[model samples]
Target: MEKASSVLAALFGSREPAEAAATVTSIFVYPIKSCRGISVPQACVTSTGLDLERLQWDRQWLVVNSKGRAYTQRVEPKLALVDIELPMDAFKDNWEPTDLSYMVIKAPDMEALRIPLNKKCAAVDDISVWEWSGSALNEGNEAFEWFTKYLGKPSRLVRFNTELEIRAVDPNYAQGYKTLFTDGFPFLLASQGSLDGLNELLDEPLPINRFRPNILVDGCDPFSEDLWKELKINKLNFHGVKLCARCKVMCLFVDDTGWPWSVLSACKEMSGREVKGCCCREPLRLLAWAMEMASNAAADHGCRQPVSLVLRILPLLGTVPCQCTAPASASAAACAPLSCFIPTINQENGVTGNEPTSTLMKFRSDHALKLKKTQGKMFFGQNLVCKESLLPPRGSKTIAVGDPVFVLQKYSSNVDAPI
Candidate 1:
């Protein structure tokens, strides 16, 4: 068995420098837990992190007890399946608008139960919701009644209050930004190759959600992200703070059908149990170091790679164009005009050129490019271009001055790299 210390040392060690800088292929944000996510071609960089302008944390709603402690889905796996909807103008109106959003949890027989919003419906009962840190949040009664009634277990609903800013444990650290209820930090990272490798060893593949990573990267080897201490996706950058240790929670069956011994046995054999409460003993720090080292090693090996990274955006929901003319105008006029750009490598190898104005950007080996309108025009593109295009290899060719390029739609997979 590989000692944990050995793994850590190998991952943290220095290696050959990168020949060329890496670029981001796509970005994704999940507003609600266990539900669909919103994908934006572009986003704004913020001190806390990337802000997609609409996508926010869905699990930000807290289920608390009468004592104000939080409850976790750990005991009730069904909680992982609950769905939430946030108000579009919560940021501007401070939860005062009559159209406050609601949440719904799926019941047996495909039934949907609504959790109410507003002060009038606030006092139903209280329940507890658990955070990743094992802390409990005591939520109101109304939330409790809504959760327990549908879950058939004692539970309650709680909303994340921006006014009640919860800061990270390390204020000076990168993750210290204010947030409601996230695992611990604002981001989570995982690799598709790592998951694929694990599935290869198992009889059946586990769903990616079993790990609950906020950021999923593709095009790299399994477990390569552990080495990335710092990364840039266009104008946005992330400084990885800690390694995410593997816990027993990973072995716990998420389908609510009881624990699966086969999966547990496989995990125990693969990663020896060191931690007590968690299933897997892998430490967050160690994992982070491993990823950083692996990425460096790959770059050193002369393999250009494509990578997909996800970020959470604030203001979970927003208003869209309605049928009414005024509302339509308002919605349409909300965003500034935007355009996508592709940066193609010129024949000179070192030289680069922007795509023709009349040509729509298309997939190419050099790189995928996009241009977002912030204060000025910002470009974003994704392609294997160097070593990272998601698509298979095509012979190297140079673009003529007047060649046409068409911008392709972004991928929707958890890891949205072009294929």
Candidate 2:
């Protein structure tokens, strides 16, 4: 017990969220699972969908290997070489409120292929993601044929169940939270300050895309995301569940989760680890109180049930062997063009194919009780779960870059479960 206590003190380094609510730095979506992403000005956040365009959710489409395992950068670094796009009016051109006819894809030697998006109501197929299994809308023969040719391996294309009710988030962190294709949650949050700090530590100043968060924020201390409890941006409320575990996908090369692992571990190891409790109710505010108030406040607020906790605090691309990063510093006038993000890697000199991009970024966070080295080494973005809501709500819940974000509630950490 004494040894465990020592580790916590070193991990919680002497730091706090150095400032209050910050601005949305960037917004990104992996339209196709594991391929590449598109940065958008706005997205409609939903419990079951990414920012909505008509009704399309981020990562609604996916690619499967011969055995039906979902193909991600975990095993296929070449997946990064593929390019996917979702134009602003992507919905207007090929999609309608009722029918999402198709989307077009392009890659090095392959001609642009327009894959249809009409399989949701069709037959279902046995598909597996990680250890979970579910039925998906298989994209039919043409897509299968195309993917097989493009990947040079047997591959199939599948869509999320249009019902948007199949996959569920880990209930331990989020109750009844549903998602599709994502490793778990519907959202991820990273901070600009964290990325800037990471750049200072690396051989090459990396781009934010290296980490792949759903949302990015600016104007906070480096690695401060690890300190967030609850957050609100636009109409959607997001809770930080766990820090995003680093994956090899970040560096676009398959070397066992790469630099991000080192980055997250550094953040996890430097903090003071005493699992202290704070009032952390909505619209997050700091208070001066005595130790006596802890138990009384806990009983009054209760646990397991969520509250409004209003806050005003805080806070991907692809391919061509894509060199994508979340925006470095985004504003209305100077968004980085799509071309700037996709380029060849000049590995020798550590330069990208095009001129240096001003990328904005965020990393995953953890309520990590790092009692050991292996446990401390694998997290980056703040994993997020959408609040319970019906699939396809009556109105859209939108969030985007430049949107205002608030610190809503308390950070959650359970000492009993560290795995």
Per-model TM values vs. the true structure = 0.44, 0.62
Worst 10 residues of 1 by lDDT: 290-299
The reply for model 2, stretches above 4 Å from the true place, is: 1-20, 47-56, 90-101, 118-121, 247-376, 388-392, 412-419
**Top TM-score model:** 2
Clashes of each: 72, 44
What C-alpha RMSD separates each model from the true structure? 22.5, 19.1
| Global CA lDDT computed for model 1 | 0.33
lDDT of 1 by residue, 135-233 (tens): 323345554566677556565555554332333423344422434454445555555675676556555455455445544556666544544554543
